[model samples]
Target: MAFKEFNCPSCGALLKLEYRFTETVICPFCQQSSHWTGENFEAKGEKVILADYGSKFSVGLQASFWGTKLGERKEYKFKVLGRVRFEYNDGFWDEWLLRVEGYEQNEYWLQEDEGEFFLFKKFDNLPSVNEYSELEVGMYVDWEDYKMFISEKAKAQISGGEGELPFRVIPGEQCDFVDGILLKEAIPVSIEYLPDNKKAFYVTIFNLDINDFVFTEKKQENVY
Candidate 1:
C-alpha cells in the first residue's frame, strides 16, 4: 500500500489514491467524481455524499477482530480504507475495503447490511455464466466442490462512495446481483454481473458479531 496523489480536475483539491488499481477518485473537498483515463482524470460530475449512519466503521479507522473462519481461529488487525454504498429495494449496504496487516496483498471486503456483517474474499475464478439473465433464483450451482443454492437476486445501483476504490464508480450505475449459500456450512456467496461483462464473486469467510471488533483508533469528533 503505497499511494499516489492527484489534483482534482474540478476543484483543484489534492486526492490521494490508497488502492493501487483505483479507477475513480472522489475529491473529498468538492465531492466531485473523476475517472482515470490512463492518461489523465476526467470529470464524471459530482457524486452524492453518503450520510453517516454511525455504523462503527469509517475510512481511516483502525480496528482488530478475533474470529474463526472455516474452522480455523485467527486474529486480524486492519484499517478501513474505503467504502462503496449500494442501494437496492431493501435499502442499502456498505462494502468496506480493508487492508489486513501482517499479510501481503491481504485486502478483504467487509460487507455491512442492516445489523449483519460478513467477511469475504474475492474469488478470481468466476462462475461460467456470462450474463445474469442466464441464472435464476432457487437454482443449485456446484462450483469448487461446494453446492450452493441461490438465495436472492436483485438489481442494485452505486449510490455513493468514499475514499479509494479499485474500480470506477459511476453513480447510479446498475448491476445484477445473485446471492447463494452453502447449505451445510452456511457460507454465503455473492456474484455481481456489471456492465461490459465485468463480473466479481465474493466468498464469505467469516460471520462476524459486533463484539468481535475492537477499535484501535481513538474516536475524533467529525471524522466520519
Candidate 2:
C-alpha cells in the first residue's frame, strides 16, 4: 500500500492520501473536509516529507520529572519513560528518554531542511491525559485548549517593548511566563517501541501560516 501526503485546509492536518475512491476524508484533528480533486490531482498541491532518526540519541523506558512555578524558572527531569528507534540520516538511532507533558507532548511534522515543523490538530473537543492514552501516532488531536509555555525573560522582553524583537505577533494567543507564547492546538501522539518493551507518547502539531513549523525545545514541567 502507498500513502500520499495531503494537508487539511481548515485545520492544517496532514493526511495520508490512500483511498482513491475516497473523494472526501474528514480530518481527524479538525473534523474538516479534505476533498480530493478528481482531475489533475497530482497538481493540486504538494506533499510534505519527513526526516529519519539518526544515531545521536539512545532510546529507553523510564519516568520523567516535571516541575513548574508560576513566576519562577521551570525545571525538567526526564526519567526514561521508554525507548524508541528514530530513523535519521538513512540509519536508525534510539532515543533513550522521551518526556511526556500536556503541552510538550504535541506532535509536529518536521521538514527535510530541519528548519520547520508543522503542527496539526482538530479544534473540536480535546481529550484529557487519560483519554490521550488511546491515541496513536499520526492520528489527529484536538488543539482547542492547548497552551504555550515561555520563560520569564521572554515575557519580560515582550513587556518592555523597547528593543527589536525576533518573533512575530501571534493572534488570539496568550503570552505566558516571560518569554513564551501560548496556543491551544497542541495535542499528544503515542510513541511506539521502547527499550523496556513499553510504549511512550509525545505531542505533534501542524503549522497553518508558515510553510514550515519548528518546535522550540522547552524544559518539560508539570502544567498544574
Q: Which is the leading candidate under TM-score? A: 1
lDDT of each: 0.79, 0.30
Local accuracy of candidate 1 as per-residue lDDT tens digits, 135-189: 6789887767878888889999888788777677888888668998877988898
- The local distance difference test score of model 2 is 0.30
Off by over 4 Å in 2: 1-56, 59-71, 86-96, 99-142, 146-224
TM-score of 2: 0.21
How many angstroms is residue 221 displaced in model 2 relative to the true structure, after the best TM-score fit?
30
Q: After superposition, how far is residue 134 of candidate 2 from its true place, in Å?
A: 18
After the best TM-score superposition of candidate 2, give how far the Cα of residue 39 lies from its true spot, in angstroms: 53
Which regions in candidate 1 have their CA more than 4 angstroms from the true location? 104-107, 125-130, 218-224
List all candidate RMSDs to the true structure. Answer: 2.6, 19.4
